[model samples]
Target: MNLLFVADPLSSFSVKKDSTLAMMLEAQAKGYAIWHCHIEDIKSVAGAIYAKSQKIKIDMAGSPWYVSTQTKEMKVAAFDAVIMRKDPPFDMSYVTATWFLSQAKLEGAKIFNDPVALRNHSEKLSLLEFLQYAPPTLISYDLKDIQDFHREHQDIIIKPLDGMGGMGIFRVKSDALNLASIVETLGDSGKRALMAQKFLPEISEGDKRVLVIGGKAVPHGLARIPQGGEVRGNLAAGGKGVACPISEKEAKVAEHIGPLLASRGLHLIGLDFIGGYLTEINVTSPTCFVEITQQTGYDVAKQWLTSLEQYLK
Candidate 1:
């Protein structure tokens, strides 16, 4: 099988933790051809989508880790599968890339986490669709409205709508120190929107990342526990990741939501849960494959590829 990964530059990959790299390694082990490209390399010409991509070999022990055997322009449909593994700031550029990928789908390209689904689901805000399992949340650009939410909740977490890896997340306590400042910074003086959720003290335990693959939740989840004085439990924010069995509640929620998202073409999803409440629906580039596998002895990447194979069949 031929697989094309539309991702960031290969130079940026961390071999130790990058889930895309893990997938590539697994695909290579399975004797599948692998190609790589950045979103910018995708283009539309004469109503057909093409990518200026490189057929690459991954060598874990090598200094550079990858060798580009061939670089050529190929129709998006030529590949058996196209994996959208780009990380997000989810700006206009990302949106435009998805538009092209969506067009590619029409041209017979099979893309995972379908381009249209990527465009439709906001990682932080999509949780509103399943609010029965979510905390009290508010998404707004108005500082007053956010402040009112803070006042009502007494403790809250505010973050940018497009932030990832826990960037731009702030925890405001009941005292509300720096509340206005945080509101202005995140909201950009009402020029940009932000999300505010009633703080879940269970964060002190950990922020559990429940991976839903092939319409089922992985039995074990990686709990990213905050270190020191950190309020964010994201691994990028200096947290420790510990893999553990998912709770019954988590399994139930995953069983319910996983198939729905899979039916929408999101073959893989990362559902963030804090204090047993659904927090975010991470559709774009959901990770933790390496950590979960290394810690729990569960091959998440293998499971993902198995699911992909079944999906294609």
Candidate 2:
């Protein structure tokens, strides 16, 4: 099957840790026609969405890496499926790209983790819909709301509503100096929303990252425990990854959201939980397959592409 992946610059991928890169490499190994493009390369001309892209081949186990390039104008429909693998700052351009992809979908390209559903859900806000399974979360820009949360939860964590990879996330466990000022300075009021939740003590065990592919749980994943003095449990944020098993609580989280999201076009997703409470439902830029592969010696890219092939069938 032919697949197009929209991502960052071609040379920026670290297939060692990036699941998207690993997936592309795996697909190329299987003789699937793999193509790559960036969001900036996507454009609309006369009501058609096109990209300046190149077909690439990768060897996940090799150093020189695999190679193939066909720099040409490509349409989304030319591929069997479009994998939107770009990373996030989730700015205006990202939303606009999703809008363009939805148009491409209407014209007959199959998009995984649905473009329209992604633009609507935006990861963080979507989890609020299943609040019962999640910790006490507050979406507010109001300083008073944050202050009140600090007063009640006493130990509260504040994160940007659009945050990913644990960026711009902070813990306010004490009445530290300028706590109120920091809250206002970090998370804007009225204009944007910040997620304030009761800080969980179990975070030291590392947060659990569960990858859902084709509406089912992938076998291996990691428990990313935060280092001492760190509240954010992201690998990039100094969190250590330990090969850990998923608990019944993590499975329940997947069971509840998997079918619903898959039906909505979110065929692949990464759901984050810490100490068994739901945190984020990562629809856009869901990662962890690389770590999972390293831990269990299975190629998740093969699993994902196989699912795409079945869907195309």
Return the top candidate by TM-score.
Answer: 1
Error of 1 at 176 (Å): 1.2
Estimate the TM-score for candidate 2.
0.95
Query: Over the stretch 127-225, how does candidate 2's per-residue lDDT look in tens digits?
Result: 878898899998887888888878888888888887778888888876655667667777653567788888999998888888888887776668898
lDDT of 2 at 176: 51
Once fitted onto the true fold, the runs of candidate 1 whose alpha carbons sit more than 4 angstroms away are none
Q: Give per-model TM-scores.
A: 0.98, 0.95
Deviation from native of the Cα of residue 144 in model 1, angstroms: 1.9
Instruction: Extract clashing residue pairs from model 2.
Output: 114-265, 206-224, 206-225
Question: What clash pairs does model 1 have?
Answer: none
Cα deviation of 105, candidate 1, in Å = 0.5
Q: Could you tell me the lDDT of residue 268 within candidate 2?
A: 92
What lDDT score is found at residue 51 in candidate 2? 79
For all candidates in order, the CA lDDT equals 0.93, 0.82
